[model samples]
Target: MTSEPAQHPFLKMANVNVALGDRNVLHDINLTIQTGEHVAILGANGCGKSTLIRTMTCELYPAIPGLDQPRPEVSLFGHSRWDLTELRKHFGVVSDSHPGLYSTSRAPDTAGSSTGRTTGLNAVIAGFFSASTLWPNLIVTDEMRQRATEALERIHASHLINHLVGEMSAGEKRRILIARALAHRPQQLLLDEPSNALDLAAQRDLRESLRGLIADGVGLILVTHHLNDIPPEIERVILMQKGRIVADGPREQLLTAPVLSDLLGTEVRIGEQDGWLHSW
Candidate 1:
């Protein structure tokens, strides 16, 4: 986890607009995720928070115009996304949409032969492979495996290495998903609602994990609807209302009653737990 970008403008957005069918989902949108910033995209359901996340990462919502989503030419590091394949070694994405179907088993077909025996740790391990799990030559070094073990240990998922996904609790699966994300060793973590299904204790663990991440200087952009999900290290908030960013500034400036209450469209009380911001 590195601190700031080696250069300026790691991710830039300009005049971005997206629509779902005839309904306009995103207005003329513009935003940027800085090198050292950890921003949380907050909004009510159907307020286009999820839509914005998909669009920013070049993913299309169901029943959209074409089969594939259209992504603007993004300049990551210094090269365009087209020519930046190798350069993309610096990026990682974590989403709830990932199915447990894909795996890290060197013999995916072998696992396919028998259904229901893969653990969450196994799924997390699968994230290490660049391609599908069916590749004949699957190789992971001892150190990398050790790192994976350490990552799971960080989240208390090490004990679940042998427990199949079907047997593990929801929180366990979520932790594994996060562990998989860390396997990418991302400098900037894009979390698509990391706390969505977590319980209070699990959420606390995630908060601590995020604290550790920022402590090491990794940038993060977490998409969440609740104020509590906003990690303490996050200095800024980008409130999204009706697909466009309504407010963007420091947490102290934007997380106030006037700003957040307006964005949420209801009266809510905000409280701070440790360094995190919470709404009630």
Candidate 2:
């Protein structure tokens, strides 16, 4: 009899702890995520969701194990360490608060900074270097430009190609940032509060874009505090509280009013419309 191939996990963490400055932000985090899985990491502000994302991206390292303690295990694609430049090829990261998304260049004589003035297409191409903007020293080949154009098309932001990122609306800028992340054609995307500071119309548009990505088989690891940010395609939900994961389960089970009320430390009411959940 033939046997099935073993499944390889995209990410795994056991007994992981992270500290920022003097505070230990993540504690005893045990998580396993398979390739192509759609999952949401839900939490309130200050719950360490951002820290966890950083750790996954290798921007932050876990606390070293004590001599008497078992070593903490954290791996991505079964590897414990990665080169950031190469890592961007496999996993794209987008955060609403990323300064690069709003970065701008100033005149050589100017004393103050401004919003990012790079055009959308150039910004996407910069993804290859994991840079905020294309620098004079960077070499962008024809293939890179083509890939950047394709990424914009995939996100339905081709119209934004020539638009300056600083001049685009919040929604437009968000789309450009997403295109930047997609430029490398990564297998999965890690998003942090992607819908933050967006209006009603923009939020709807962002969700539609996300759905399209999911349809194209790009796995998503979405971290957000807003219930509405959880796309319908996401079936698994992991809840974090006080720097720890408190619950991890199917969305239908963990998104109930009582569960959310406890998680948010308030009396919460929820409603569903067209597979999207809203909280009150």
Tens-digit lDDT track of model 1 for 25-59? 87656677777677877888877877876654545
Error of 2 at 32 (Å): 0.4
Best by TM-score: 2
Q: Which RMSD does model 2 reach against the true structure?
A: 4.3
Q: Candidate 2: lDDT of 37?
A: 86
TM-score of predicted structure 2 = 0.90
TM-score of each: 0.79, 0.90
Report how far off residue 173 is in candidate 1 (Å): 1.2
Q: Which 10 successive residues of model 1 have the least lDDT summed?
A: 100-109
Tens-digit lDDT string for candidate 2 (1-280): 0221124477999989888887899999999998788999998899999889878877788898779876788888777877666767777788744443322222221212223567789877876776667888999999999999999999889999987766777788788778878887878788888888789999998999999999999989999989999889999999999999999999999999999999999999999999999999
Best by lDDT: 2
lDDT, model 2: 0.82
Clashing pairs in 1: none
Per-candidate Cα lDDT values, in order, are: 0.64, 0.82
